[model samples]
Target: MGISEMRRTGEGIDERSNFIMYHKGEVAGHRGVGFLVKLNLKSQITGFEGISDRIAAIHIHLPNHSKNWTVIQVYSPTEQATRTDIDNFYNNLTEITEKYSENNLVIMGDFNAQVGARAPGEEQIIGKYGSGKRSENGKKLVTFLLENNLTILNSVFRKKPKSKWTWLSPDGKTRNEIDYILTNKVKEFSDTGIIQNLNFNTNHRMVRSCLCESGTKKPRPKAIQMNKTQISNEIWNPITAPEDLMTVATSDIDLKEKYNKIENKLKEQTRTDITKSQQTYLSEETIKLIEDRKNLITKKDKKENQKEISNLSKQIREKIRKDRIIKRNKTLENYISKTGGTKKALKELREQGKEWITKLKDKNRPTISRNKIQNIATDYYRSIYKEQNPNQTKTQLPAKQQNIYNINKIEDIPEILESEVEKSIKSQKMEKAPGPDKITNELIRGFQVNGQNRT
Candidate 1:
């Protein structure tokens, strides 16, 4: 996982979620850090420094902005590291933060610290919404922020305790907000919180924050962000499935009706889940705003409607742009990757800029036209098939092959024990891609195996 990509591209041991990479490896490649900058932003970068394997920085001077932005990305030593290593890391960070202290600076990445809620004297650095107890490193973080005059942006925003955590412990017994974004210009922050349901490919829940500048009074950003955890808990309510939900789906008409019923049940469970959105990238939160806009279209408050519509439109566009940037990363372990894919998948990825098959060859004749090629292909396939006798009992097979059903070995396999199924589910790695049912492995792990093996 690239700690550098944690903010925009995501970080994890599996395949990276970005096409572009800016990485620095540390700790024997385990703690490799990298960034994925958009083309427009990359062009504005005045400078970048790979200070060390565990840290890096990018300097950007936005057009007409009075000050430049110096982003210092870091990955601190873990709790188990020697005290010297930890101390050295903080010392290095202190130097870098001091260097860009004058700029509109932002520091981000895995701090591996829990600052918890706001403390008595840390009103300027820490906010009331922080979660988990402050660890030793958390104290160090608080001191660092205070010394540097940086605000913990995520902490300033109210959120569910469940939605505040950035990392989930291996055993799933602990959830802590260790990853963070600290900025000297806190008033520019429009929103901040954990972005749940994102496929970050890491135990750490992705954190996101919005910044809006060019204003007189820096009012606290009131845009309440939504995440999957909050949506599923407060919005979605599952309907009970009928006992014979699948039994009556034998005929085409029966299947269609059953499918429609199930679809409606899902929609009814989440009242505003319904949407005819054109963009595949739109999230539940964005869709809800879309519904709101639709309702506003028919109201008498044209003035209010126009203002909100413009704001929603701008937000929707921004969300799409960011979501597009976040969607390009791919891991090598996946069935299909940038370097590996089936013939068809590879063809699409390669994008050779032309049709792969421009012409077809005819075997029986030396000369052939494009139209004739189609006829020849059609005739060839037609010659391979023939009408079968309607009275035939079953399909015939070669002696060695026999019939597929005749070689059945179903009875030879032992019955699967419920305990075994439970163990399998429990052992499944979280955040894995789901199977044909679209039920993720994490969700499947939550189900109970109620019975024992067949006797």
Candidate 2:
């Protein structure tokens, strides 16, 4: 079977680790809300991604307890970066990691930058294709390694001299060592600092580090099988001595008061019935006396029931009313924060005026299309021009002047011709506001005109 077949055999971990505890009772890591389960290796290995750009997933290689190798995969599907950029990106890899003391710290990837330019003592060439110089981008990568205090274990200086280059360009024109194997602990690489190149038929060269010799193996941890059904009996344990005492006292007092009121009520009802019967029997001339007593009993029972129901209804209504008042106050406070109360009336009036203007403008818009109006105006202009200039040839003026003349007629048409003529009439009436009468004898002698008043 293939590696995929091996992975499929261990697929029982699909739903086992879907939920995880991070911190104390934060109720987090649910799928889609904060994280999502991403499957790889054909229903075998599972992963998670965040809603935000980057995601980090931790897989428990061991059976129990989080003492396992964590995979921090940074997926940048659309990003193409210089060596400096990728170096800066993964520089803070160990910042938030829960470090395991005895376990291994394996950091291996396609670094995309070489260790040194021309085997250390040569002039550096930056960004020149296939130049083996320690480029400026390469320096940034070195700085990132130094800042993290992570050793470049795959370095030619540390490894054997013959095993320097690990990767080569497919075009045969360029060859440089780029991929890396790094670790914080020195024991992770078996003290030899060996870097061997594997001639695999892939873009990446596989670099593996061993912590022990072939016989001395890492100790396997015991499996911790959790019984899911065994809930902790002390789950709800807290300091409840004061609350327990208070509850006992309150319950006792409430029961005593309730029983006393019931007893008093029963006595008062018996006395009232006796008084009613005595009054009824004193006037024994009344017919249907038995029916009257029965009606009285029924009425009293109904009144008692109705009184209890009304009290309960009032209690519910009062609670709802108080809740509504609180909500209304909160809403008012939010409104005040947005717009102060001093401007509320003015704001309402302004909104009303704006709405009115919008409605009026919409009402006044022309029902006919602009082209239809243009045709009608052209016909009216032709008629007006013919009436004004009788017996004249159509090509008398320049073509531009003729067009202008036709346009001028449309403008000079009567004000009553347009639709919404009432508004136009109202506007004219407003413009021609009536002036004070000046028909006195002195004013009549001052003008001395044959036409109307010039004063």
Model 2: residues >4 Å from true position, as ranges? 1-68, 71-88, 91-104, 117-133, 156-162, 191-200, 213-455
Write down the TM-score for model 2.
Answer: 0.28
Q: lDDT tens string, model 1, 1-455?
A: 22543332222211122223455554553665666565535346555556677787767776646898888788888778899989898899999889778899888889898888887888899877776688999998888888888899888888877678877665546767889998988877788877654421245766777777564754656853445455455533122223223333344566678777654433333333422112265567767766666666446553445566566667767776665554333222242553365554333334223211213556744321334555767887887885677787986788766554566643476799978886777778854555544445533343222332111
* Best by the lDDT measure: 1
lDDT of 1: 0.63
What TM-score goes with each of the models?
0.45, 0.28
Model 2 misses residue 63 by how many Å?
Answer: 10
lDDT per residue as tens, model 2, 1-455: 00000111101112211232111111233111111223222232222212112223333242322334443333221125664645445544445233422343445444556656333321121111123456454565566556555555554234433345555454434555665555555443464232332211232334545554434466757854433234222232222422333344357467777555434433333334334433321122223333343343345343343344344445545555565565456556755776566344334223221110001112355322223444556676888877655666665788899899899988966565444553443344211212343122222122222332222
